[model samples]
Target: MIMRPGHQQLLLPVNPFFLWASLIVALLLNMVPLGRAAWLPDLLALAIVFWSVHQPARIGIGAAFVFGLLMDVHQTALLGQHALSYTTLGFFAIMVHRRLLWYPLVSQALQVLPLFAISHVIEVAIRLVGGGIFPGWQFLIAPVIEATLWPLASLLLLAPQRRAPEPDANRPL
Candidate 1:
Protein backbone atom coordinates (compact mmCIF):
# COMPACT_ATOMS: atom_id res chain seq x y z
CA MET A 1 0.00 0.00 0.00
CA ILE A 2 1.23 3.46 -0.88
CA MET A 3 1.68 5.77 2.08
CA ARG A 4 1.38 9.54 1.64
CA PRO A 5 4.05 11.87 2.96
CA GLY A 6 3.91 12.38 6.74
CA HIS A 7 1.75 9.28 7.03
CA GLN A 8 2.95 5.87 8.09
CA GLN A 9 1.89 2.65 6.45
CA LEU A 10 -0.01 0.20 8.56
CA LEU A 11 2.06 -2.78 9.56
CA LEU A 12 1.27 -6.05 7.83
CA PRO A 13 -0.04 -8.99 9.79
CA VAL A 14 2.77 -10.65 11.67
CA ASN A 15 3.40 -14.37 11.77
CA PRO A 16 2.76 -15.98 15.13
CA PHE A 17 5.83 -18.17 14.75
CA PHE A 18 7.99 -15.15 14.05
CA LEU A 19 6.63 -13.43 17.14
CA TRP A 20 7.48 -16.39 19.37
CA ALA A 21 10.85 -16.85 17.75
CA SER A 22 11.80 -13.25 18.49
CA LEU A 23 10.76 -13.71 22.10
CA ILE A 24 12.94 -16.82 22.32
CA VAL A 25 15.90 -14.96 20.91
CA ALA A 26 15.35 -12.14 23.38
CA LEU A 27 15.23 -14.68 26.21
CA LEU A 28 18.54 -16.16 25.07
CA LEU A 29 20.07 -12.72 24.85
CA ASN A 30 18.86 -11.97 28.36
CA MET A 31 20.52 -15.18 29.53
CA VAL A 32 23.89 -14.23 28.09
CA PRO A 33 26.27 -13.48 30.97
CA LEU A 34 27.18 -9.87 30.47
CA GLY A 35 28.75 -9.63 33.93
CA ARG A 36 28.81 -5.94 34.95
CA ALA A 37 26.77 -5.10 31.90
CA ALA A 38 23.97 -7.29 33.17
CA TRP A 39 22.12 -4.05 33.86
CA LEU A 40 22.47 -2.99 30.25
CA PRO A 41 18.88 -3.76 29.31
CA ASP A 42 16.28 -6.50 29.68
CA LEU A 43 15.87 -7.68 26.12
CA LEU A 44 13.18 -10.15 27.14
CA ALA A 45 11.16 -7.46 28.86
CA LEU A 46 11.66 -5.15 25.90
CA ALA A 47 10.39 -7.85 23.53
CA ILE A 48 7.37 -8.49 25.71
CA VAL A 49 6.53 -4.80 25.89
CA PHE A 50 7.06 -4.37 22.15
CA TRP A 51 4.75 -7.21 21.22
CA SER A 52 2.25 -6.27 23.89
CA VAL A 53 1.96 -2.79 22.39
CA HIS A 54 1.95 -3.73 18.70
CA GLN A 55 0.23 -7.13 18.75
CA PRO A 56 -1.79 -7.38 21.91
CA ALA A 57 -4.00 -10.20 20.59
CA ARG A 58 -1.01 -12.48 20.07
CA ILE A 59 1.05 -11.44 23.11
CA GLY A 60 -1.16 -10.50 25.97
CA ILE A 61 -0.94 -10.59 29.75
CA GLY A 62 -0.97 -14.38 29.83
CA ALA A 63 1.96 -14.58 27.49
CA ALA A 64 3.85 -12.01 29.51
CA PHE A 65 3.16 -13.97 32.67
CA VAL A 66 4.40 -17.16 31.06
CA PHE A 67 7.58 -15.53 29.80
CA GLY A 68 8.11 -13.87 33.15
CA LEU A 69 7.78 -17.24 34.87
CA LEU A 70 10.37 -18.61 32.49
CA MET A 71 12.67 -15.70 33.30
CA ASP A 72 12.26 -16.19 37.02
CA VAL A 73 13.05 -19.88 36.63
CA HIS A 74 16.12 -19.12 34.54
CA GLN A 75 17.36 -16.51 36.99
CA THR A 76 16.48 -18.53 40.09
CA ALA A 77 14.84 -15.49 41.63
CA LEU A 78 11.53 -15.49 43.53
CA LEU A 79 9.19 -17.58 41.34
CA GLY A 80 6.50 -14.97 40.82
CA GLN A 81 8.63 -11.84 40.80
CA HIS A 82 9.09 -11.50 37.06
CA ALA A 83 5.61 -12.80 36.42
CA LEU A 84 3.92 -9.97 38.29
CA SER A 85 6.17 -7.34 36.80
CA TYR A 86 5.60 -8.52 33.23
CA THR A 87 1.87 -8.82 33.67
CA THR A 88 1.76 -5.27 34.91
CA LEU A 89 3.81 -4.13 31.96
CA GLY A 90 1.49 -5.92 29.56
CA PHE A 91 -1.51 -4.27 31.15
CA PHE A 92 -0.09 -0.82 30.68
CA ALA A 93 0.96 -1.62 27.12
CA ILE A 94 -2.52 -2.76 26.23
CA MET A 95 -4.05 0.31 27.82
CA VAL A 96 -1.99 2.61 25.64
CA HIS A 97 -1.67 0.49 22.52
CA ARG A 98 -3.98 2.53 20.33
CA ARG A 99 -2.54 5.88 21.37
CA LEU A 100 0.97 4.55 20.84
CA LEU A 101 0.16 3.49 17.30
CA TRP A 102 -0.41 7.11 16.31
CA TYR A 103 2.98 8.46 17.32
CA PRO A 104 6.34 8.32 15.56
CA LEU A 105 8.77 5.64 16.69
CA VAL A 106 10.78 7.90 19.01
CA SER A 107 7.65 9.35 20.51
CA GLN A 108 6.30 5.87 21.06
CA ALA A 109 9.46 4.98 22.95
CA LEU A 110 9.18 8.08 25.08
CA GLN A 111 5.55 7.31 25.85
CA VAL A 112 6.39 3.80 26.99
CA LEU A 113 9.02 4.96 29.44
CA PRO A 114 6.56 5.12 32.31
CA LEU A 115 5.43 1.57 31.62
CA PHE A 116 9.03 0.36 31.70
CA ALA A 117 9.63 2.20 34.95
CA ILE A 118 6.52 0.65 36.47
CA SER A 119 7.74 -2.81 35.53
CA HIS A 120 11.07 -2.18 37.23
CA VAL A 121 9.31 -0.74 40.26
CA ILE A 122 7.28 -3.92 40.57
CA GLU A 123 10.43 -6.02 40.48
CA VAL A 124 12.11 -3.86 43.10
CA ALA A 125 9.08 -3.97 45.33
CA ILE A 126 9.07 -7.75 45.12
CA ARG A 127 12.73 -7.91 46.01
CA LEU A 128 12.28 -5.58 48.95
CA VAL A 129 9.40 -7.60 50.30
CA GLY A 130 11.52 -10.72 50.06
CA GLY A 131 14.15 -9.16 52.37
CA GLY A 132 16.60 -8.39 49.62
CA ILE A 133 18.80 -5.33 50.13
CA PHE A 134 18.35 -2.22 48.03
CA PRO A 135 19.99 -2.76 44.65
CA GLY A 136 20.99 0.95 44.50
CA TRP A 137 19.99 3.75 42.17
CA GLN A 138 21.92 2.11 39.35
CA PHE A 139 19.18 -0.50 39.22
CA LEU A 140 16.94 2.15 37.67
CA ILE A 141 19.16 2.30 34.61
CA ALA A 142 17.60 -0.66 32.87
CA PRO A 143 14.32 1.07 32.10
CA VAL A 144 16.09 3.98 30.47
CA ILE A 145 18.15 1.59 28.40
CA GLU A 146 15.11 -0.41 27.43
CA ALA A 147 13.22 2.69 26.37
CA THR A 148 16.16 3.91 24.34
CA LEU A 149 16.35 0.60 22.50
CA TRP A 150 12.67 0.63 21.67
CA PRO A 151 12.95 2.05 18.18
CA LEU A 152 15.71 -0.34 17.21
CA ALA A 153 13.75 -3.30 18.51
CA SER A 154 10.62 -2.22 16.63
CA LEU A 155 12.58 -1.81 13.41
CA LEU A 156 14.27 -5.19 13.65
CA LEU A 157 11.15 -7.11 14.58
CA LEU A 158 8.96 -5.42 11.94
CA ALA A 159 11.43 -5.65 9.07
CA PRO A 160 10.12 -8.98 7.83
CA GLN A 161 6.52 -7.76 7.84
CA ARG A 162 7.10 -4.46 6.04
CA ARG A 163 5.78 -4.25 2.49
CA ALA A 164 8.07 -3.71 -0.49
CA PRO A 165 7.73 -0.61 -2.65
CA GLU A 166 5.39 -0.80 -5.63
CA PRO A 167 6.57 -0.22 -9.22
CA ASP A 168 5.52 2.99 -10.92
CA ALA A 169 2.21 2.30 -12.76
CA ASN A 170 1.38 5.86 -13.80
CA ARG A 171 4.53 6.61 -15.78
CA PRO A 172 4.13 8.09 -19.29
CA LEU A 173 4.56 5.57 -22.15
Candidate 2:
Protein backbone atom coordinates (compact mmCIF):
# COMPACT_ATOMS: atom_id res chain seq x y z
CA MET A 1 0.00 0.00 0.00
CA ILE A 2 1.21 3.50 -0.75
CA MET A 3 1.95 5.42 2.40
CA ARG A 4 0.89 9.05 2.74
CA PRO A 5 3.38 11.91 2.67
CA GLY A 6 3.80 12.14 6.42
CA HIS A 7 3.33 8.48 7.21
CA GLN A 8 5.36 5.29 7.32
CA GLN A 9 4.40 2.22 5.36
CA LEU A 10 0.89 0.94 5.94
CA LEU A 11 0.78 -2.32 7.81
CA LEU A 12 -1.85 -5.00 7.47
CA PRO A 13 -4.02 -5.73 10.47
CA VAL A 14 -1.99 -7.66 13.01
CA ASN A 15 -3.17 -10.94 14.47
CA PRO A 16 -3.41 -10.80 18.23
CA PHE A 17 -2.21 -14.38 18.50
CA PHE A 18 0.93 -13.54 16.54
CA LEU A 19 1.49 -10.52 18.75
CA TRP A 20 1.37 -12.55 21.93
CA ALA A 21 3.43 -15.30 20.35
CA SER A 22 6.18 -12.79 19.57
CA LEU A 23 6.15 -11.63 23.14
CA ILE A 24 6.40 -15.24 24.29
CA VAL A 25 9.38 -15.78 22.03
CA ALA A 26 11.03 -12.67 23.45
CA LEU A 27 10.46 -14.00 26.94
CA LEU A 28 12.07 -17.25 25.93
CA LEU A 29 15.01 -15.35 24.47
CA ASN A 30 15.43 -13.49 27.73
CA MET A 31 15.40 -16.79 29.60
CA VAL A 32 18.19 -18.30 27.56
CA PRO A 33 21.32 -18.86 29.61
CA LEU A 34 23.80 -16.46 28.07
CA GLY A 35 26.21 -16.62 31.01
CA ARG A 36 28.66 -13.74 30.41
CA ALA A 37 26.38 -12.13 27.87
CA ALA A 38 23.47 -12.31 30.30
CA TRP A 39 23.56 -8.53 30.30
CA LEU A 40 22.70 -8.42 26.61
CA PRO A 41 19.76 -6.51 25.25
CA ASP A 42 16.36 -7.23 26.77
CA LEU A 43 14.53 -8.70 23.81
CA LEU A 44 11.24 -8.70 25.69
CA ALA A 45 11.55 -5.01 26.49
CA LEU A 46 12.38 -4.23 22.86
CA ALA A 47 9.37 -6.24 21.70
CA ILE A 48 7.12 -4.53 24.22
CA VAL A 49 8.26 -1.08 23.15
CA PHE A 50 7.87 -1.99 19.47
CA TRP A 51 4.32 -3.29 19.85
CA SER A 52 3.28 -0.51 22.17
CA VAL A 53 4.37 2.02 19.57
CA HIS A 54 2.94 0.19 16.54
CA GLN A 55 -0.18 -1.36 18.04
CA PRO A 56 -0.99 0.34 21.31
CA ALA A 57 -4.48 -1.12 21.55
CA ARG A 58 -3.23 -4.67 21.30
CA ILE A 59 -0.31 -4.28 23.71
CA GLY A 60 -0.38 -1.87 26.60
CA ILE A 61 0.75 -1.35 30.16
CA GLY A 62 -1.06 -4.37 31.52
CA ALA A 63 0.71 -6.70 29.14
CA ALA A 64 4.03 -5.12 29.98
CA PHE A 65 3.36 -5.43 33.69
CA VAL A 66 2.42 -9.08 33.37
CA PHE A 67 5.51 -9.83 31.33
CA GLY A 68 7.65 -7.93 33.79
CA LEU A 69 6.24 -9.99 36.62
CA LEU A 70 7.00 -13.12 34.69
CA MET A 71 10.58 -11.96 34.22
CA ASP A 72 10.84 -11.25 37.91
CA VAL A 73 9.69 -14.77 38.73
CA HIS A 74 11.95 -16.32 36.15
CA GLN A 75 15.04 -14.31 37.07
CA THR A 76 14.32 -14.44 40.82
CA ALA A 77 15.05 -10.74 41.09
CA LEU A 78 13.16 -8.47 43.50
CA LEU A 79 9.48 -8.46 42.76
CA GLY A 80 7.96 -5.64 40.67
CA GLN A 81 11.19 -4.14 39.33
CA HIS A 82 10.62 -5.20 35.77
CA ALA A 83 6.94 -4.41 36.15
CA LEU A 84 7.66 -0.82 37.11
CA SER A 85 10.18 -0.40 34.32
CA TYR A 86 7.96 -1.86 31.64
CA THR A 87 4.86 -0.01 32.78
CA THR A 88 6.73 3.26 32.56
CA LEU A 89 8.13 2.30 29.19
CA GLY A 90 4.66 1.44 27.92
CA PHE A 91 3.26 4.72 29.15
CA PHE A 92 5.88 6.73 27.30
CA ALA A 93 5.54 4.60 24.19
CA ILE A 94 1.78 5.09 24.12
CA MET A 95 2.24 8.78 24.73
CA VAL A 96 4.38 9.06 21.60
CA HIS A 97 2.79 6.31 19.53
CA ARG A 98 1.21 8.55 16.96
CA ARG A 99 4.28 10.70 16.53
CA LEU A 100 6.53 7.68 16.45
CA LEU A 101 4.48 6.09 13.70
CA TRP A 102 5.49 8.86 11.36
CA TYR A 103 9.17 8.09 11.49
CA PRO A 104 11.11 5.48 9.54
CA LEU A 105 12.41 2.47 11.48
CA VAL A 106 15.91 3.87 12.04
CA SER A 107 14.54 7.22 13.11
CA GLN A 108 12.09 5.47 15.38
CA ALA A 109 15.03 3.78 17.07
CA LEU A 110 16.67 7.16 17.65
CA GLN A 111 13.46 8.58 19.07
CA VAL A 112 12.97 5.60 21.35
CA LEU A 113 16.40 5.92 22.95
CA PRO A 114 15.14 7.94 25.87
CA LEU A 115 12.26 5.60 26.59
CA PHE A 116 14.64 2.66 26.73
CA ALA A 117 17.08 4.65 28.84
CA ILE A 118 14.35 5.70 31.23
CA SER A 119 13.29 2.09 31.73
CA HIS A 120 16.87 1.11 32.47
CA VAL A 121 17.22 4.02 34.86
CA ILE A 122 14.09 2.93 36.70
CA GLU A 123 15.45 -0.58 37.04
CA VAL A 124 18.73 0.72 38.33
CA ALA A 125 17.00 2.91 40.88
CA ILE A 126 14.99 -0.02 42.13
CA ARG A 127 18.05 -2.21 42.46
CA LEU A 128 19.89 0.51 44.30
CA VAL A 129 17.02 1.07 46.70
CA GLY A 130 16.88 -2.65 47.30
CA GLY A 131 20.55 -2.55 48.42
CA GLY A 132 21.86 -4.40 45.44
CA ILE A 133 25.46 -3.48 44.73
CA PHE A 134 26.10 -1.37 41.70
CA PRO A 135 26.53 -3.66 38.72
CA GLY A 136 28.93 -1.07 37.23
CA TRP A 137 28.95 0.94 34.00
CA GLN A 138 28.52 -2.24 32.03
CA PHE A 139 25.00 -2.50 33.38
CA LEU A 140 24.22 0.61 31.35
CA ILE A 141 25.20 -1.05 28.10
CA ALA A 142 22.04 -3.04 27.71
CA PRO A 143 19.80 -0.05 27.06
CA VAL A 144 22.07 1.21 24.30
CA ILE A 145 22.14 -2.23 22.82
CA GLU A 146 18.39 -2.44 23.06
CA ALA A 147 18.04 0.87 21.29
CA THR A 148 20.49 -0.23 18.61
CA LEU A 149 18.43 -3.35 18.01
CA TRP A 150 15.19 -1.42 17.79
CA PRO A 151 15.09 -1.24 14.01
CA LEU A 152 15.71 -4.94 13.59
CA ALA A 153 13.09 -5.72 16.20
CA SER A 154 10.60 -3.46 14.48
CA LEU A 155 11.25 -5.16 11.15
CA LEU A 156 10.98 -8.63 12.64
CA LEU A 157 7.81 -7.98 14.61
CA LEU A 158 6.11 -6.11 11.79
CA ALA A 159 7.05 -8.56 9.06
CA PRO A 160 3.83 -10.50 9.34
CA GLN A 161 1.80 -7.33 9.40
CA ARG A 162 3.32 -5.94 6.24
CA ARG A 163 1.02 -6.06 3.27
CA ALA A 164 2.09 -8.27 0.40
CA PRO A 165 3.06 -6.58 -2.84
CA GLU A 166 0.16 -5.95 -5.18
CA PRO A 167 0.15 -7.39 -8.69
CA ASP A 168 1.16 -4.84 -11.34
CA ALA A 169 -2.03 -3.76 -13.06
CA ASN A 170 -0.14 -2.35 -16.05
CA ARG A 171 1.76 -5.53 -16.85
CA PRO A 172 1.55 -6.62 -20.51
CA LEU A 173 -0.42 -9.82 -20.78
Candidate 3:
Protein backbone atom coordinates (compact mmCIF):
# COMPACT_ATOMS: atom_id res chain seq x y z
CA MET A 1 0.00 0.00 0.00
CA ILE A 2 1.22 3.43 -0.92
CA MET A 3 1.73 5.80 2.00
CA ARG A 4 0.31 9.28 2.18
CA PRO A 5 1.64 11.88 4.58
CA GLY A 6 -0.40 11.87 7.83
CA HIS A 7 -1.98 8.52 6.98
CA GLN A 8 -1.58 5.88 9.68
CA GLN A 9 -0.03 2.55 8.88
CA LEU A 10 -2.55 -0.05 7.81
CA LEU A 11 -3.77 -2.15 10.73
CA LEU A 12 -4.06 -5.89 10.70
CA PRO A 13 -7.48 -7.46 11.10
CA VAL A 14 -8.89 -7.28 14.65
CA ASN A 15 -8.96 -10.54 16.50
CA PRO A 16 -12.44 -11.56 17.63
CA PHE A 17 -11.21 -12.98 20.90
CA PHE A 18 -9.33 -9.79 21.72
CA LEU A 19 -12.34 -7.67 20.88
CA TRP A 20 -14.67 -9.54 23.21
CA ALA A 21 -12.01 -9.75 25.85
CA SER A 22 -11.62 -5.99 25.91
CA LEU A 23 -15.36 -5.54 26.42
CA ILE A 24 -15.38 -8.07 29.23
CA VAL A 25 -12.45 -6.33 30.88
CA ALA A 26 -14.27 -3.03 30.66
CA LEU A 27 -17.33 -4.60 32.25
CA LEU A 28 -15.20 -5.97 35.05
CA LEU A 29 -13.71 -2.55 35.60
CA ASN A 30 -17.21 -1.16 35.94
CA MET A 31 -18.17 -3.93 38.34
CA VAL A 32 -15.53 -2.87 40.84
CA PRO A 33 -17.05 -1.70 44.11
CA LEU A 34 -16.61 2.00 43.67
CA GLY A 35 -19.97 3.05 45.13
CA ARG A 36 -21.19 4.48 41.82
CA ALA A 37 -19.76 7.97 42.06
CA ALA A 38 -21.29 10.33 39.51
CA TRP A 39 -17.88 11.58 38.42
CA LEU A 40 -16.48 8.14 37.82
CA PRO A 41 -15.97 7.30 34.16
CA ASP A 42 -18.15 4.57 32.68
CA LEU A 43 -15.52 2.14 31.46
CA LEU A 44 -18.02 -0.03 29.62
CA ALA A 45 -19.50 2.97 27.85
CA LEU A 46 -16.04 4.19 26.91
CA ALA A 47 -15.08 0.80 25.52
CA ILE A 48 -18.39 0.52 23.68
CA VAL A 49 -17.93 3.89 22.07
CA PHE A 50 -14.33 3.05 21.17
CA TRP A 51 -15.23 -0.20 19.48
CA SER A 52 -18.37 1.20 17.86
CA VAL A 53 -16.29 3.91 16.25
CA HIS A 54 -13.44 1.65 15.17
CA GLN A 55 -15.31 -1.55 14.33
CA PRO A 56 -18.91 -0.63 13.79
CA ALA A 57 -19.87 -3.87 12.09
CA ARG A 58 -18.76 -5.99 15.00
CA ILE A 59 -19.97 -3.73 17.83
CA GLY A 60 -23.25 -2.04 17.12
CA ILE A 61 -26.41 -1.02 18.95
CA GLY A 62 -27.29 -4.58 19.83
CA ALA A 63 -24.08 -5.16 21.73
CA ALA A 64 -24.45 -1.86 23.49
CA PHE A 65 -27.96 -2.76 24.54
CA VAL A 66 -26.81 -6.05 26.01
CA PHE A 67 -24.02 -4.46 27.98
CA GLY A 68 -26.31 -1.69 29.17
CA LEU A 69 -28.83 -4.20 30.42
CA LEU A 70 -26.08 -5.95 32.32
CA MET A 71 -25.06 -2.68 33.88
CA ASP A 72 -28.62 -1.95 34.91
CA VAL A 73 -28.89 -5.34 36.51
CA HIS A 74 -25.65 -4.87 38.38
CA GLN A 75 -26.49 -1.38 39.55
CA THR A 76 -30.10 -2.30 40.24
CA ALA A 77 -31.22 0.77 38.37
CA LEU A 78 -34.39 1.11 36.33
CA LEU A 79 -34.58 -1.49 33.61
CA GLY A 80 -33.37 -0.24 30.23
CA GLN A 81 -31.89 2.94 31.69
CA HIS A 82 -28.33 2.13 30.69
CA ALA A 83 -29.65 0.34 27.64
CA LEU A 84 -31.25 3.47 26.24
CA SER A 85 -28.23 5.66 26.95
CA TYR A 86 -25.67 3.19 25.63
CA THR A 87 -27.72 2.49 22.53
CA THR A 88 -27.76 6.19 21.81
CA LEU A 89 -24.02 6.37 22.39
CA GLY A 90 -23.33 3.44 20.09
CA PHE A 91 -25.67 4.77 17.41
CA PHE A 92 -24.03 8.16 17.35
CA ALA A 93 -20.56 6.67 17.38
CA ILE A 94 -21.39 4.43 14.43
CA MET A 95 -22.93 7.33 12.54
CA VAL A 96 -19.72 9.32 12.79
CA HIS A 97 -17.24 6.44 12.64
CA ARG A 98 -16.00 7.03 9.12
CA ARG A 99 -15.61 10.77 9.48
CA LEU A 100 -14.16 10.53 12.99
CA LEU A 101 -11.30 8.32 11.83
CA TRP A 102 -10.04 10.92 9.40
CA TYR A 103 -8.83 13.23 12.13
CA PRO A 104 -6.00 12.90 14.66
CA LEU A 105 -6.82 11.22 17.98
CA VAL A 106 -7.16 14.54 19.80
CA SER A 107 -9.67 15.79 17.25
CA GLN A 108 -11.46 12.47 17.39
CA ALA A 109 -11.71 12.85 21.18
CA LEU A 110 -13.27 16.27 20.76
CA GLN A 111 -15.81 14.86 18.35
CA VAL A 112 -16.78 12.10 20.76
CA LEU A 113 -17.18 14.40 23.75
CA PRO A 114 -20.69 15.29 22.71
CA LEU A 115 -21.65 11.65 22.37
CA PHE A 116 -20.44 10.96 25.90
CA ALA A 117 -22.26 14.02 27.20
CA ILE A 118 -25.46 12.94 25.49
CA SER A 119 -25.20 9.46 26.95
CA HIS A 120 -24.80 10.88 30.44
CA VAL A 121 -27.71 13.24 29.90
CA ILE A 122 -29.90 10.34 28.85
CA GLU A 123 -29.00 8.38 31.96
CA VAL A 124 -29.58 11.34 34.25
CA ALA A 125 -32.86 12.15 32.55
CA ILE A 126 -34.09 8.63 33.05
CA ARG A 127 -33.10 8.69 36.67
CA LEU A 128 -34.90 11.99 37.17
CA VAL A 129 -38.01 10.66 35.52
CA GLY A 130 -37.94 7.71 37.87
CA GLY A 131 -37.97 10.08 40.89
CA GLY A 132 -34.30 9.76 41.58
CA ILE A 133 -32.70 12.71 43.29
CA PHE A 134 -30.49 15.10 41.35
CA PRO A 135 -26.88 14.02 41.29
CA GLY A 136 -25.58 17.59 41.28
CA TRP A 137 -23.10 19.36 39.00
CA GLN A 138 -20.46 16.74 39.65
CA PHE A 139 -22.22 14.48 37.20
CA LEU A 140 -20.97 16.73 34.43
CA ILE A 141 -17.41 15.58 35.06
CA ALA A 142 -18.00 12.07 33.77
CA PRO A 143 -18.26 13.00 30.10
CA VAL A 144 -15.14 15.11 30.18
CA ILE A 145 -13.21 12.33 31.83
CA GLU A 146 -14.47 9.86 29.28
CA ALA A 147 -13.43 12.19 26.47
CA THR A 148 -10.01 12.65 28.03
CA LEU A 149 -9.58 8.92 28.10
CA TRP A 150 -10.35 8.59 24.38
CA PRO A 151 -6.82 8.99 23.07
CA LEU A 152 -5.50 6.52 25.61
CA ALA A 153 -8.24 4.07 24.80
CA SER A 154 -7.60 4.27 21.05
CA LEU A 155 -3.89 3.63 21.45
CA LEU A 156 -4.43 0.75 23.87
CA LEU A 157 -7.27 -0.94 22.02
CA LEU A 158 -5.58 -0.70 18.65
CA ALA A 159 -2.23 -1.90 19.93
CA PRO A 160 -2.77 -5.52 18.97
CA GLN A 161 -3.70 -4.68 15.40
CA ARG A 162 -0.77 -2.31 15.06
CA ARG A 163 1.85 -5.00 15.59
CA ALA A 164 3.72 -6.34 12.59
CA PRO A 165 2.72 -9.87 11.62
CA GLU A 166 6.33 -10.87 12.19
CA PRO A 167 9.18 -8.64 13.30
CA ASP A 168 11.71 -8.38 10.48
CA ALA A 169 14.85 -6.28 10.23
CA ASN A 170 14.69 -6.26 6.41
CA ARG A 171 11.07 -5.06 5.97
CA PRO A 172 9.42 -2.01 7.50
CA LEU A 173 5.68 -1.95 7.83
Q: How big is the positional error of residue 45 in model 1, measured in Å on the Cα after superposition?
A: 0.9
- Write model 3 residue lDDT over 102-168, tens digit each, in one string: 8888998899999999999999999999999899989999999999999999999999999899979
lDDT, candidate 1, at 124: 82
lDDT, candidate 1, at 131:
89
**Model 2 regions lying over 4 Å from their true place:** 1-8, 36-39, 165-173
Clashing residue pairs in all predictions, respectively, total 0, 0, 0
Task: Supply the TM-score for candidate 1.
Answer: 0.89
Instruction: Give the lDDT ranking, best first.
Output: 3, 1, 2
Pitting candidate 2 against candidate 3, the one with the higher lDDT is: 3
TM-score of each: 0.89, 0.88, 0.95
TM-score of decoy 2? 0.88
The C-alpha lDDT values of all candidates are: 0.86, 0.85, 0.94
Off by over 4 Å in 3: 1-5, 169-173
lDDT of 1 by residue, 127-165 (tens): 899987777887789898999999999899998777544
Native-referenced Cα lDDT, model 3: 0.94
What is the lDDT for 102 in model 2?
Answer: 72
By summed lDDT, the worst window of 10 consecutive residues in model 3 runs over 1-10
| Model 1 alpha-carbon miss at residue 7, Å | 1.1
Instruction: Point out the higher-scoring one by lDDT: 1 or 2.
Output: 1
